[model samples]
Target: MASLRRVFATSILASVLSQVLTATAQPAFGVCYGMLGDNLPTPAAAIQLYKNHNIGTMQLYDPNPEALQALGNSGISVILGTKNEDLPNLASSVEAAKSWIDAHVLPYQGVNIKYIAVGDEVIPGESAQCVLPAMQNLQSAISGSSFSSVAMTTAVSGTVLGASYPPSSGAFTGDAKRALSGILQFLSNTHAPLLINVYPYFAYAADPSNIRLDYALFTAPGPVVRDGDLSYWNLLDAMVDAYYAAMERENFPNVGVVISESGWPSAGNGNFTTPQLALTYNRNFMKKIVAGTGTPKRPDSHLDGNIFAMFNEDLKSAGEEQNFGLFYPDGTPVYPIFS
Candidate 1:
């Protein structure tokens, strides 16, 4: 009897420990490492900063050679992007895609490349025509390589949605719908998630009259928007669900959605972009991702996403674009995000 009691106690303790470890492990949340700043740290130091904060993933805006080299054997997952200018060539021939992978990706065998974003916010424009072909060619190229497991996709802005007021009524704009039809189908067939840059800050900044700040910041006291049986407490989930609904409408319901970029600016806007609000939104966003919370539309889905940026970019367009970093150029935490 004594031996059985001891075994039971040990089992209980192990279970509790497992739960604690699971709760603390936040592999789903990541930060986008933007290199528009001339004063940013070296690739090695930037990688170290991510490690110091326990950020397990990174979203690189391009296949930066130095960043890739630094990421080797670092155990950090990466979402590598391709330059928009290269899209025409990548779409024109499969050989160009293979060459790109050979030049940029194959050299870094130790880097854990998760997704290869073909372009950033290029859809519904001239580059939109090149996106699908580039993705297809890249997919073919990747399939023949060791990094075949890497998902190939592109990131798009929330402006693609023509109707998103009610989550259920979400549908893509005519141009965006036309462009995404093939892309969405490809995503469904390949099991790759669509990378979306969902910025609630932009939405709120655009229309503060109807959109409450608490709803956008995930601090709503209760359900702010009731879409039938689904209640939205925050704008992030609503925006994400809108994309899901739009995809469902487009007949690609199985294709997943990954938020490639989302963050609040710390300055450059009056009364809207402040450090405290940025900290609150990011902290709450990280909590949601860490908890593996899903939206009401997809209750069982795990929300995998990257925060907008790692450090403020001085060279980006003036104003809020330059102020989205969680850290300053010197690698100090702008706010206690990891804390």
Candidate 2:
């Protein structure tokens, strides 16, 4: 009897130890390493930057040879973009789009080149008429190419969804529904992520009272607004759920939606939110994201989001928020996002 009791106690301790080790040994996470800054490090050095910091993935606005060669074999998946100017040309010629991919995308196959974004924020307006053509051309190019597994899609603005505040009320704008529905059909046919960019910062700025600061910052939630079993405990999930609803309305509800851009700016329009607060917002949220905390709606979905700009661009055209970087230009650590 004494021997059996001792054996049972040992088994219990071993099980407890196994659980603790499993929790501790979980991999850190991934992030988007953007190079929007003028004084940013060379692509080679930038590769080293994320490597040292333990970032796993990155997104490039364009598939620059410098960046591709640098990130090649670094084990980082690259998200390439189409410049707005190139849109008109790409739209006009499928051959040009194919050639562009051959030159820019083909070479990086085994090393990187995960997705080729058709263009950014195209919603078919007076300004966006030039973009959809590029999308059609790019899609054609991808279809003809051997690497269709490399996702061929575009990143759309969260604003495309008319009302995002309440997740259920989300839908595309009047005319946008037609354009967006087509885009969704393309995404559905081709297995690609939605790549939706959500900014809770805009929500907080627009109406601080109605929107909880903690919720917007993704800090900690109190008793949150519950809509049946579909409760939104915070802004991030709320924004994501809105995307889910939009996708559902299009009948491609199972389609993947990734957070293409989501982070807080340290300083901005009036600087009401403190630098520390900004750091807290980004650092904490990223930590949670990397820890595999999916939105309330999609618990099993990959929450591995790509945060905005890797380095803060000092010459960022305008406002301070436009800077939107994880690091300052001169290789100085703006804040310890992981620590």
Candidate 3:
């Protein structure tokens, strides 16, 4: 009797330990590592920067070999991307997809690669045709390989949706609908989340007269918008819920949504792009993610978000594009983001 009791207690302790380890393994938030700049730090130094800030995941704009080498054995999750131009080639030939994966993915044996994003915002017009085929081929390639556990999907722009204001009224229209529907089907089949780049800054910058700065920064004085029974305190939550509503409208309510890119520019041509505003937005955004409170529409679900950039890209032509990074090229943070 005593031996059986001891065995039962050991089983309970093992179960509890497993739960704790699983929770610890999951990252609360991550940052985007855009290597579009001329003076960004080397991969090794950049990895240390992420470690210093406690960023447990990284979304790279491409499967950079140097970056992969630095990330190996670091335990940071990676979401590597394939350039849009490569999509057509990859879509046309499964062998090409396998070759690309073998060259880029198989070589990084020790890196914690979590997902492979096919292309960025390619679900529109001519490029839309390549999205699913590339994803399918890539999925097949991964399934046959040792890296089958890595999720596959593409990143889309929030501009793909129509009538996103009321959240509940959101829908994909015209070409976007056809393109997104097929992509949604692929995601459903593979059990991969739909990654969307949601930037409230763009909306607010386009129409400052109607959009409150505090609301856009997630520091609203009160709930600024109401959709059906849901009250949204900030623009981020509304934007996220808008995607959820759009997915539900397409009969894909179970498909998960992950924010592939989101960040406030520290400097731009307008008053809304001040460093203080950027700091406030990113800090609050991180807090919201860490708190594990999902958007009003998907309150029970945890939303994974990646901040737009690690370093400001000096080479970007657009003023705002060069200003999105949380850090400067020399490894100095543009502002205090983490506690």
Candidate 4:
């Protein structure tokens, strides 16, 4: 009897410890740490800002050595990127992919490298042809290394959706279908999520007359649109579900979707581009995700996303491109994110 009781006690203790670890290790909402600005803070200071704001995840456009070094032992999850220009080299040779990983990823000791995004919005052309091969090679390299826990994915734009209205009608068009199929197959095999950049701001600005500002801002008074049985109260949810539907149509309905980037520009040419609007949109977005309410199409799943930028990148093209940052280059908050 004492032996059975001991076993039971051990089992209960193990269960409790598992639950505690799961809760503590849950991924926090992330921000994109873009380094396009001339006056952005050093990576160490940037990590401090992230710590201040309770941001536990960060996405970088490239694996800069300094940034990777700063992230070490920081307890922050990182999603690193390989620039489009390097895809050809990585894809052409598995040795190159392994070498790149060794140089960029392996050295970052204790930094929780979650995902390696191969390229940003690469469509099926000469560059796009290299994406899948590079991803495959990278995945193999990571699997063989100490960082096998890291996953591989590519970020694509919402323009890949052929028909987005009504959400259920979503499907990939043209070269997107071919490119995405290979990606989806890879994701399915590895159980990695699809990273997509969903910009309701761009969608709204493109057709302001048709897209309601309140809906785009996630302050919809009521259901803005009903597609079949699913009712969408906000544009972000709809935009995400459109990708879900597209994936479903591709017969990979179970693959997860991660919004790699989404944010409203604080200043630009658009009538809706203002600090107040940006603040409203970002706050509302943060609240919705924190609430853990998934889209109507995937109500049981928590959607993981990263806000577009950490600072307004002055080096970007004129207008909205330079105004997505939540902070100034000097690490000053452009607006309060948490209140």
Instruction: Quote each prediction's TM-score.
Output: 0.92, 0.85, 0.91, 0.91
Give the C-alpha miss distance for residue 290 in model 3, angstroms: 1.2
Per-candidate Cα RMSD to the true structure, in Å, reads 8.3, 9.0, 10.5, 10.9
Task: Give model 2's TM-score versus the native structure.
Answer: 0.85
- Off-target runs (Cα >4 Å) in candidate 3 are 1-27
Lowest summed lDDT window (length 10), candidate 4 = 12-21
As a whole number from 0 to 100, the lDDT of residue 197 in candidate 1 is 93
lDDT of 1 by residue, 1-339 (tens): 345334433544335433543567546789999999999999999999988777888999888899999999888999999999999999998899999999999999999999999999987898898999999998898886799899888999987899987999999999998899999988888899999999999999999999999999998999999999999999999999999999999888898999899999989998899877887788778778877889999989998988989999999999999999988899876655554
Each model's lDDT comes to 0.88, 0.69, 0.84, 0.83
Give the least accurate 10-residue stretch of model 2, judged by summed lDDT.
12-21
lDDT of 4 by residue, 209-304 (tens): 999999999878899999988899999999899899999999998899888898999888667798667877876676565557799999998987
TM-score-superior candidate, 2 or 3: 3
Off by over 4 Å in 2: 1-30, 33-35, 127-136, 139-146
CA lDDT of 47 in candidate 4?
A: 84
Stronger candidate by TM-score (1 vs 3): 1
Off by over 4 Å in 1: 1-23
